[model samples]
Target: MAKKRKVDNLLALAVLSTIVERPMHRYEIAQTLCERGKDRDMAIKWGSLYTVVQNMAKAGFLEVVGSERDGARPERVIYRITDAGRVEMADWTRELLTTPEPEHHRFVAGLSILAVLPPAEVIELLGARLDALGRILEVARRELGDLTGTLPRLFLVESEFGLAMLEAEAAWTRSLRDELIEGSFDGLAQWRDWHDRGMRPSEVTASIERGVAEN
Candidate 1:
């Protein structure tokens, strides 16, 4: 089977969004993103910004409009969004908001192989994670609070979503930790026993089948 092409890029969206405002050179786009605090909403690197612009031009999402040299500076190429780019940007943004895509979060990856570690040790590690997440959540809340009077809520929606997710994860982690400490988590015994006994291939497959059936 052929692999699917990935059209989603945080930087690409940032670039397209910038170009939509007005055609600009690469440096100007980067400057605008920084000035608008787009970095808070998406990961932005100076190098990657140039690469995404090149790729967008190659994909016909953008076309070079003109070039200019300012004194000692190298000539800079200005670009504008193509008709295709506008359509792509709008479609991609809508899909990103409405569609559920598979994202590999580190916490989920650790949870997947959780049975490999002793329950007590897993609890310790997760507790550490909870502490770190708590600190991050506190920082996010403080920053949001400070920005409340300065910026409109519409501009900070993504920040709000991030803080909410962090809060939710912290809550769930606390519940799981308490269950582990109390020895009351469902299926925990079977999980511990399988791990302690050095789980066999058949046992693993059987457990997965049973879980599927139950669901």
Candidate 2:
């Protein structure tokens, strides 16, 4: 049985949001996440995603829609959001937008993992991430530009702040990419033995139970 891990609320929210749009299988969810360009930081891992989907289904936030074989592979499970999932998504979205932002450890964890990637590959990855971020930033900029006099002054200020944040992130990414290309930093193994050692016995048991339940 696969071991269970605690699911991140943001990851759960992301998966639920995507499922709300349409039903999808695990691989499809991963592909959609890549397409959405939000997984660049390695904040979302396949194991974590699979775990979340299983837990959400168990929690009644999602329902299995159907299953079908993918070519020669085994049958794939597809899922769609339950009504409860939609309500949870809405509630989370509201909380996300209205509440003060919380410090996100996932970002740090991602960077730590990225530290293990080959220097050259890291540069390439960062370039791709920057390109994706650029596209998103452009769209946000255009949308905000169109809202010049349409939105209230307070909203305009908030929008500008959001854009500024994006710009700062882009700039930081560019700086990191340049540093990597220039060979300014040496690569290090991130998460060395932590992956296996970090799992608590209780958590491992929970994961095993979850996996057995699923199977």
Report the number of clashing residue pairs per model.
0, 2
Model 1, residue 19: displacement in angstroms?
1.8
lDDT of 1 by residue, 1-215 (tens): 22232444678987998899888999999889888778877788878888899989998999999999999999999999999999888877777788787877888988877767778898898899999998999899998898887998887888889889999999999999999989999878877887788887577668878888999
Give each prediction's root-mean-square deviation over alpha carbons.
3.7, 15.4
State the weakest 10-residue window (summed lDDT) of model 2.
Answer: 187-196
Worst 10 residues of 1 by lDDT: 1-10
User: If scored against the real structure, what TM-score would every candidate get?
Assistant: 0.82, 0.49
lDDT against true structure, model 2: 0.74
Local lDDT at 69 for model 2: 95
The CA lDDT at 23 in model 1 is: 88
lDDT of 2 by residue, 1-215 (tens): 21232344578888987788899998898888776545743488888888889999988898998998969998999999999888888877676677675467554667864634455676788899899989989998997788788767664665677789889888998998897777665332222222335655455456557768999
Candidate 2 Cα outliers beyond 4 Å, as residue runs: 1-8, 104-163, 166-215
Off by over 4 Å in 1: 1-7, 194-215
